[model samples]
Target: MKPTIIPFLTTRKLNPENQETPIHFLPQTITLKEYFFIRNHFEYPTQTQEAYFLPIVGEVIRPIIFKLEDIMRMPSKHLMLPLECSGNNRAFFHPKVYGEQWEDGAISQGLWKGVPLKDLLALIGLKRTALEVVFEAYDYGKRMDLEGDFHFARSLPIQKALHPDTLIAYELNGKPIPFKHGYPLRLIVPQWYAMASIKWVKRIVVIDHLFKGPFQEIDYNYYPYKDSDKGKTPVAQINVSSIIQQPQSYSILDNGKHVVEGIAWTGTGVIIEVEVSTDGGESWHKAILGQEQSHLYSWTFWKYDWKVSSKGEYLIMSRARDSFGNIQPFKAKWNRKGYGYNAVYTVKVKVE
Candidate 1:
């Protein structure tokens, strides 16, 4: 196993390990490549420049193979998108759940440059019968709970697959993607959770029916309580959420005034407002919103100033609301898989 290069990120291991960026390092609009969160289901695959080729097959007019040079020759698109793990904030679940116990750091925004997946799909000419597009990655390994080994694969609806913003990314933050980040090529599904953006992409297959892979059908799904009427749904887009990045949680500060800052993001729409509560949930104050990228998929930075009149223990919390009227819930809906935990976040600190 490769050691984590980012010293500050928290690492969790199963068969393939994953790392999350620290909250304190999230103030910047564009996260550095080194600090980007890493979630791997299998060991990173090794690909040489000479051996890289992406095959597009299954329900298509003509099966086509795209080499790295071919993809680079296509018109490139650059987008600043925020990718969050569906299981972000899973650590806060009341009953401890299985899987990565991510806090608020399993997310990062980056400028990605790549060929639009639609452009590639156009090259192969998708048949009218194609209903779903399956993306296959090179990484393969065994699961602790499952019986045999399998490669990572996920499918997106025909509409999402053809979305102009969806990309087969080759560059991250203007540089060639690092080896740990899928190197030559990866999928970038703009408004969806990072799981939908398969890394180390080696094949794109158009199918006439929905995919039933383990990662799609069994895992990455939200299983609600038995008594609830809500049926099981696949985890996709991010929920409205906010986090406190500045004034590290539980830090001792001199009595005076301090500025609290953090980020707010949503996959449904643009984040319009963020509210911060200094004393738990008793009173709330609106935070000053910072300039955000024109892209609706990017995160909005926000800050609020708090005047500390005396020294005492305080609970700080933040909640975000999106343009679609979706707001962070006080208590996240529980699910067996611990996916999409986007409840209001709170941190306790002391003033000396």
Candidate 2:
């Protein structure tokens, strides 16, 4: 159960066509407390501290039930990484898709402090055969299915679980997490988008087979294969993506020299080339890539300097080609529910 005194957090809603979508940044520039973007799956129930239980069971030598306070009593580590929703840029797709139409701001980088999962697993004892780690959230009272009420949970592969980067975060930015963004505790998965990071986290289950809970089965997970493709399989990993930060969508710019900047990251490999095109997709110019970052899963800043001549409305687009030649297309791999959108980012602007 969630603790009492859950505070109300503020967030800005986005209008798809006008802006680039709010990236859910934890606005550090202003405000007494950091902001949080709540992903409301169901109604919020009054959560108490006692009912907030974390069951560490399945494929374990000894099962242990952990309390929210117990985990907090342990050591805490702090680190920063960028996290974005997998369906963040989905609304930009011409036909439009389901899920929240997020702006680039939905992606934010922040510092988090929490006890490492590996440490907790050691205290509880781990079985050698354990291959996956499952996290269950408290807000499972209401759901998107007809099976009545069930708990909301998600799982991570054992390999990624033990990795140093994965965190059981309690604090966002410099303060404690607000109720809206999974107060008490939440899972943070770097490199991958927000979906990998489970909110309102409560339980951890170690298992051998893939843990197919409601969120896993009915939502979040997607098939890279199109509807027309037969015998297609649903994959769980996130795809590569990049987005322009400044001059979102269409900003009026006077015909002059300007520098364009953005951030890019890949789930599989490194981003080798980020090309920018001012005139549709005909010609391309290479952007100077920044230095390699330390955290393999975090995004890196990229920029390109360009000069504009004459006056009229112009459309600018950016396409990222990773080291593997996986180029960002104008249209993403479409789906009934938008999951991975690696389409070429196009922004229209008037040049006076």
Candidate 3:
């Protein structure tokens, strides 16, 4: 069956299927599956739930193959998580990074139901020498840079893999995960960017050494020296960031009271504050954080009431600060691959 596309999402690519969410109009706490942003590196893999089986092997005393029925009968866990594309807001990067030019909507939060990966590891009896856990997906395609077709795979540190929150998810928002997202099973790695959450998971390999796949060593690594490959670091945690959902750029409004609201999230810790700027960063005020309950890995809502009396163009900006005191920077550090662009979000609006 052909996947249904929402009219509001901004289309970036067709074959691999990348779309940005229309976050401006979405005011709900949890993003619906249809409205969530879609990011894919290769063509979607076709898998039948009845025929699917996930094998866990390597660096384990008791490797096991689990079918969909076995997974469903195991213990279940639920978590509210926000997943953001590593390249979200890549278009805004200075020097024009070459990749998907996503804006602010490449993120969405959902309640995921699954079995804890730690439980799976416990059942498999992870060996003491295990260093990393690699997840291989069924999706495979040829890349222009690589000669042969490669399966979409990524690895997480053994500690992260054993974390209680890491899950092998099968359901999204109380429904079976859509094929476009990840049907039968997908890994949900909290705190880290979504790339670590490999979809269409076919195999899990616990390695005694680091697993350096193309997605790990080549693409997601942040090259600070732009032209050179020195001092490059792996992109892991999501940087503290905020997006101005309402009063979009180039919006014209009458001079009066307006409620400017948005969302802020961080991978390191909970977002404690979000500040707003109306005079192009000249002055700042804290936005009132919504009283709604938010989980550790979910985005927090924030709003500010602005009463404008003068008529002119106003540059509205929002900066978020996390519990760890990591605040959004004026301009995100430039990188070659354009991953993790978390600069303070700015939107320009006119007041009549």
Candidate 4:
């Protein structure tokens, strides 16, 4: 087993590997490459930088192919982005959902270095008819839910594809992304769920209509109703959520003043505030939001100095509110696939 594989909580060990980060003790800033969470839908494909190339075809003025060395020589940009799997907290659903069954640790953040996708799109020049940009990955396999083998492909709106922040990342934390992650080239879609950031990208196709790949239409979509198909929407943005990292659930602590620390993040807006509740949602107190540790597309660090004078069992909870007036709900919207479970995070601890 690889050294990187030892630390994560393994969800799937076979054809397509999936691992969750140990978020309980993660660093306050960037999540190291070794400790980053891994979410894969298909088995690894053999790749060599020398033999790699990206072909931009469909709905373009002229089809072009970009070699690895040539693309690497172009001007690059760096960004710190947080990627949370659509199924990050699937295991927490009331009625167990059928999926990876991931816990809170399925999200991770990294400083990505790459070329902004808009630059490359400008080189090829998009046609006015282009509506969606489809990203094709190298990995392919048959899934139990699907009938035949299918490559893990997804599409983004033309506007989002041409966004200045979207990147075709080649490096993570100043080093080449590991094989477990997208090594040669990976799409880093900011603020969106990690599903939009397709890994192992080899082909880019722009179409005039919606691209109905299984990963997009069937898998990563949101089904609001219990059984009916009402209000089915695509899973895109990350929900407003916060995680408690310092004093873990069911931990025994000294009857004294303790610091409660955690992280909160959102997709479309900045995290304006985070409320920490020690009495199990009875009342909430504002935490000190770490502005220095925040970025446009990264999670924000929050801390609260909680004093415990009497010794007893205590329940702690944290919820976040975004700049767009989106607050964390008391209960998350239930879905069949269990995509975005962003309810208030609560933990029970014993004070001795």
Candidate 5:
């Protein structure tokens, strides 16, 4: 039985399996310890910068290797970005699929500092016709259901891999990353979900076409919109999502005023608004949006107040509309693989 960290486990490997578990927290002002749910394809190997070696390999003119000191000596770039699981909140829909059983705990934000992927590629002298670059890591070994070693790994398309925002992150939240969080070297594909940000990286290979390992071809890749044309629907990017965070449920009200607040974000743009419903979804009211953040990918906060009339059980829900005018779905579409579930967030409380 695989052990899990706290608040990170949505369901067990047993019947209650849910892989789309959401990471519940605002992207700004993060404490390293509280970053919601960590998904590692492999165990965190122990190796300091001096001991480990990072090599660029395959179809390249000059294969380069960097020691820890070499990487730290370079000019580092920092980016504060938010990432969400494509399958976040998928269990809310029908045909429950396999994944972390995430309730939107599949996200987090942090100050990521590292050399950009493109810069590193250029430093190594990438070939002109390199169609795609594959990141081969130290952690990939075997498959449990399969016979061989269960190695953990994933890959990205050359275009996405070389984006300026992509980072070979060495530090998270201004501190050296913790072991559970990819420690020595990891890829941070800003704005993409955590799955794409691999840990314990060791090798990078340049190939003529997209890499098709079990991860890129089988895992992480899911068919969206159930029973649809799997061919037509490529592995879609992170869909927009929002969640409420304030007014901890089950508090006393004694016929007084109250304030409600929450956070929201989109994979594509900033959150435009957060709507609140107090009458069990009978009606909706606009909540006062909180401090606007300049980081377009970071989550935004919102708030609303309830003038308590009577005390009883209250069912509350929050909906988010993104800058692109894509509103949160009341309930998300279901898939057997459980990908791209971005539904409205709901909560309940008892008032005195």
Candidate 6:
């Protein structure tokens, strides 16, 4: 069966095509695999499942190679993780930035099944000198900005790599991962941006020092200003954000009461509350929050009752607050690369 991917702007050539899910289709507890957003940095590899093998090397006491079956034989874990592209809301940035023009659709939650990454680390026995773990994927291609061809690679500090929730996921939402979604295997890092979760993973290298790959040292880094003394910081966890899924932008609705709903999430911590404003930001009301299956990594659904009494246009907005006291800003903080745009989302709707 063909995947049910919602269409979005294609940021790159045919290989690294990008697509996002529509906000109206995101009210469910778990986003369907077909509707999940796809952001590829390279073409999907055609490696067969049986030919897939993961090599664990570098500063490990015993370097080991794991085939698909070998990993499947290990203890399996299931986690509900919501993965968001660091540039999810990049389109809203002022002055127009380079890269994908993603809106709120570049986020989705899924039940991932795989072996804990720590378990694999334990089996290999990390050397005392190991400081960071690097993940490499089969996808490789040349970019205009970079010289020569390079495979997709990223690294994590030893602490985050060893987190219990980290997994080598092979299944998404109870089905074998689709090729577009990763296929045989991928890394799922809970609470982090999707960039940290390398897809089509082929190798796990435990290094004694930081891994300075292009992705880690360049592309994903964030710079606060166009010209600043402070260097760019690596994009890691997601910021607090929410989206109004119902009564989508420019939708015409009957003049009556309607329940406005959407999903809220954060990588720093659990979302504490979500507030809704019908009259732009002039006034706000607390929205009813829903139960979260994964308190730390999954998105929380929220709803608000709107009693539209007049026939006119309304500017509906939604902002979320996380447990860490971080709330979605009225305007997104402008960054050089246009990463992490978590501004309060506003949609204009007509009531008649």
lDDT of each: 0.87, 0.69, 0.90, 0.88, 0.68, 0.87
lDDT of 2 by residue, 225-262 (tens): 44643433444545667777655666789888977777
Candidate 6 has a TM-score of 0.93
Ranking by TM-score: 3, 4, 1, 6, 5, 2
- Which candidate would rank higher by lDDT, 4 or 5? 4
Clashing pairs in 1: none
Worst 10 residues of 4 by lDDT: 5-14
**Superposition error at 174 for model 6 (Å):** 0.9
| Model 2 residue 28 distance off true place after TM-score fit, in angstroms | 8.2
* Tens-digit per-residue lDDT, 97-190, candidate 6: 8888887778878999999999999998999999999999889898788789999999999999999989999999999887788888989998
Q: Per-residue alpha-carbon lDDT of model 4 for 199-259, expressed as tens digits? A: 8997999999999988888888889767887788999989989999989988999998999
Reference-based lDDT, residue 250, model 2: 68
lDDT of predicted model 5:
0.68
TM-score per prediction, in order, is 0.94, 0.81, 0.96, 0.95, 0.83, 0.93
Once fitted onto the true fold, the runs of candidate 3 whose alpha carbons sit more than 4 angstroms away are 1-7, 49-51, 292-294
Write down the RMSD of all candidates, one decimal each. 3.6, 6.4, 3.1, 2.9, 5.1, 3.0
List, residue by residue over 264-301, the lDDT tens digit for candidate 5. Answer: 77766667888899877789999787766676666777
Stretches of candidate 6 above 4 Å error?
1-13, 49-51, 227-230, 292-295
Q: Pick the candidate with the highest lDDT.
A: 3
Q: In model 5, how large is the Cα lDDT of residue 294? A: 70
lDDT of 3: 0.90
- Check candidate 3 and list the clashing pairs: none
TM-score of 2: 0.81
Clashing pairs in 2: 1-51, 1-52, 2-47, 21-103, 22-106, 23-105, 23-106, 24-105, 24-106, 84-194
